[model samples]
Target chain A: MSLHTEYSGPHAQARSGPQVAAPPPRNSRHAAPGAARRFLSWLDLKAAPYLLVSPYFLLFAIFGLFPLGFTLWYSLFDYELTGEQEWVGLGNYSELLADDQFWKVVVNTLAMFVIATVPQLLLALMLANALNKRFRGQLFVRMGVLLPLVTSVVAVAVVFTHLYGRDWGMVNWLLGLFGIDPIDWKAERLPAWLAVSTMVDWRWTGYNAIIFLAGMQTIPRDLYEAAEIDGASKRRQFWQITIPMLRPTIIFVVLNSTIGGLTLFAEPMMFYGGRIQGGSDNQFQTVAMFIVEKAFSNFQYGYASAAAWLLFLMILIGSAINFMLIRRIGGRK
Target chain B: MTTLTVRRDTPGARRKRTHRGGAGSRIWDATPLTKVMLAFTIIVSAFPIYWMIVIASRTNSDAVDIPPPLLPGGNLGENIVRVLNDPDAQFLTGLTNSAIVAVSVTVSVVIISTMAGFAFSRLRFRGSRVLLLAVLLTMMVPIQQMGVVPLYRLMVELEWTGQLKAVILPYLLNAFGVFLMTQYTEQAVPGELVEAARVDGASTLRIWWNIVLPAVRPGMAVLGINTFMITWNDFMWPLIVLAGNPTVQVAIRNLNAQHSTDYVMIFTGTTLSVLPLIVVFLVFGRQIIGGLMEGAVKA
Candidate 1:
């Protein structure tokens, strides 16, 4: 990382503003002229680095920093749709603090983060360990797992919505084969969460598996070799070696999943019927859904901005906790 | 626990207990067991997608049969036609919208990131370190967390509520693409090459067009497909931006609104929308995986 970072420093130095390189040290036989040429090249090189690196900064400032800085400014003001506005001075945040819907959305978002993320990570780990073994048609299998991840989430949500139906649905049909009754999956709270989480699980588990598999492949064959020589069982090897070695990968998936899970939107929104009110009576409505609904449906730009910030703060803290947790796990390994 | 023995111990000892390691011949070893376990692994991994395709192919009636149809059926074409022709189904339009968004985003990402990368990796200018650091720092910020409110406001103010460009334009400078190009540019392009071009009195713009671009095209190919797949599959920003416009995914969202009565219609739409992405992956998946691996190994 340091080497790449340092290398870019030199890269920037070389491309600064367009000074044509001084004509190759002509009459270099003259010591004084040669010295002056060397000085000129050094100055040109110094200026070159700046010109090269300028675009990234300029663009980042415009696209990245400016929008973010403006978000902070907007959060403090009570601005409405169609030019209605006033300075709120933390009034929005105060209202959100007392808002029960906000808390419900927060809790619902957390419930999803726990309900979906942990099991998803575990499944991905198991799948990775399975793929780490040699197999015929390994390429086909690996590519096949990626199908769900590569496909649009909307399509997956649509497929699962079919599967989750109480009647005329494949999942219910399968359950009926075992003499089980069909389930009204999206019409209730818990079932809705399960339905939404299942969609997430199907789409993401393979992606995390591939990430884990990539990490596992980098573990030398000798580690497994050494464990076998010690008479350790394969399960023992997995627990002792694979799990510890995969700790960082686990952390990576967890962090990615945390960010993804908290912002749960389209899947649940789609599952619950994406009207102004989502879920089975807003049971599955997430903070993101709330923000979008508030912003567009009601045109409460001030209120929506507040909700967006509240969610943003929740995500920021959630992301911070995720980072802290990952670093701690990584430290253990 | 038994699965553990499969990975560690040999395949035999079923008929008679050859308990220990050296009790068996060395060559007879773990081959059969490895092959069996490997087959199980692959089957389990590939089964769900196979199930989806099979389910997608079945008629609405056969699809919900008590046993659930494991075999592919002949109704896929019928379902596809129904999906396209349905009054409420904007699937074809959505597909077109997806293509437009994905292509535009990919082209812009590749062009901008490449140019910025070349500039960062090849030039000398003032505040280069600070600017480069700023770009790198944004990588740490999840684009969704802090930027959503402001970005939404900006789009709304720009009167881009139902525009594809609303989604396509804002997230153009992908943190990963910019970072990737910068790294690739550093290696593939040497400093002396640019200097040589400069000393020859070639303009900086001319050097960029002729010399630097050729040096870093392979990187662009990897980044291009990645950007396309990413923007194409993205759910959130598009879901927000395309609220009224309705992308393929949004159409799917609307399908869910009609209840399970339209199961066949919905699956048909799902199949059509996901098929192109699967094709894209089949074509470029290896390169995408390779690029990710390259970055991982570097990190």
Candidate 2:
């Protein structure tokens, strides 16, 4: 496209050295055409795509790939605040592997994953199906469903914390209406997980629902019509038609939520605070929180990096397993 | 909407609506009622938000009532005053920080991704295929997981530990934006037109400016809003990076910590944080979904 143009604007093409505009084709033919003309066109074709892709590569190498290598390097050495260092090599990983707290964190993560993710996916699917049908006030309802994903986790955590509070909390107040007493939510493990998971399900269930809704919307109206002709009821139609058709999106949300769930932080950290360092006593201290405590509270950067790597390995392996599960589900005949 | 408004107005529209809504439709679908199910879902889903507003408008004493004030009260001003007086009251500062960072990151991302996307999808260049794949792979890497340790250390070393740039710089060129822009550019842009512009004596930049950008402006709008929201709502990265300075999200964290004793103030502060996002939704909600679906289905 740089055949000819005025360079007067901000988005204008940058100049390549002292070259003036390439001479017009007529002038070029009259002047010194053959080899140079052939070369320019080839260069132009080659250069365009190169110019297109360089930005991502340049940025990724510096920011993406380099940081990963640095993380590995940091994992090997005993980095500290007191300016002392020693070669740890595999020592950090060994320590993490043997630690009961590390395993507890893993179990905590998986438990929360099962609790929060399963319900989130199920409710999202149900809501999306319900929403796909025509209705009164549909726009308002759709927008309402999405309100939570738009809010920050910190905001969500605070709002839910208020709800989960021991005294005067809306949750406890509601339970009192059922003749139940106020519970000290943050003091216990199960209550804390329930508190954090409630926040997760509230915020994300709708986000996933929107994705499912989008998937449902595109299932081709004829698919449902065909299902109806086969004498399928609405319930049967949902499982047979909607669930099957929404498979890819179901997988997308699963993988996306798995990543988010495994790296869970903020919501739980704020929920448990000092309880996190208590290890076994803390039921909800996921691996990410465990790493955060190692780095921030204990000031063991090398140990923290090891913990982080171990967690990363778990995510990679879990993600691979999830890939298999999704494939099996998606590939179902 | 037209159906909704015109239906009841027609004496006959109610009968025609038999194929769809109303109590009888549920019977046709079966006694396993749909509206009842939907209403239940809405109540369970919407109660927390309703409860937030209810809690935010009452005093600590009133907030702790046996049957809490389900109705809105006149204590919003007092709640705000208490929330403001609290030592962790960085919400106003955080609001501005969020605006600055989200806007800057969105602008940079939009401009760069659009240019890169245009180049990949329309203007053919060497390794464009390989590079697009690389960009896609980048999207799958879950950067927050990978960047944690290095990013924290880098922030510390650069003396950006408590600065807005700590959050802003790392997020500028997100992979999702690149992927989104690629989809938009491919559809909105065409090769023949780009070639024709070049043939008509426009420079590469001129082709992008005069031809490509106008075609992709709708996309730019979507990408801009999505990127803004992503940056604005980011939690873990900013939590680790900035120590003293608080973005709106980080400020909400600080507020939660300091106002641990006062649920009403925390509720009020959270409500304040949500207000900007609500504005974001009102303005760009329709286009944001379209953008997200486009990226997802295409990928």
Candidate 2 pairs with clashing backbones:
A1-B203, A2-B203, A2-B204, A48-B125, A49-B125, A49-B126, A50-B126
Please provide, for model 1 over B1-299, each residue's C-alpha lDDT reduced to its tens digit, 9 standing for 90 to 100.
Answer: 13222222111222132232363234224456656654564565455556667766777677667666777878787778877776675777788888898898888888778877887778867665676676766765656545666777777788988898887776686877887787777766777777656665455666677877877787888788778877777767776766667777777766656644656677677778778877878887777665654443222
Q: State the lDDT at A216 in candidate 2.
A: 70
- lDDT for model 1 comes to 0.69
- Worst 10-residue lDDT window for candidate 1 chain B reads B6-15
Best by DockQ: 2
> Compared with the true structure, what per-residue lDDT tens digits does model 2 show for residues B1-299?
12222222222333354445454333224123556666776676667777777778877777778766788788988887776666676777877888999899889888878878787777755566777788876775666655577777777888888898878777864777777777767666655567555654455776778888888887898788778878888877777777777787777777766666677787887777777887878677777766665555544
Model 2: CA > 4 A from native: A1-45, A273-280, B1-32, B85-87
Q: Tell me the RMSD of model 1 versus the true structure.
A: 8.5
For model 1, the superposed segments whose C-alpha errors exceed 4 Å read A1-22, A25-62, A79-83, A179-181, B1-67, B86-88, B119-126, B144-149, B186-218, B255-260
What tens-digit string does per-residue lDDT give for candidate 1 at A5-108?
A: 43454356545645644443433445566567567656655654455444545656756777677666766777666667788878878887898877877877
Q: What is the TM-score of chain B in candidate 2?
A: 0.84
> Which 10 successive residues of model 2 chain B have the least lDDT summed?
B1-10
Q: What share of the true interface contacts does candidate 2 keep?
A: 0.37
Pick the lDDT winner.
Answer: 2
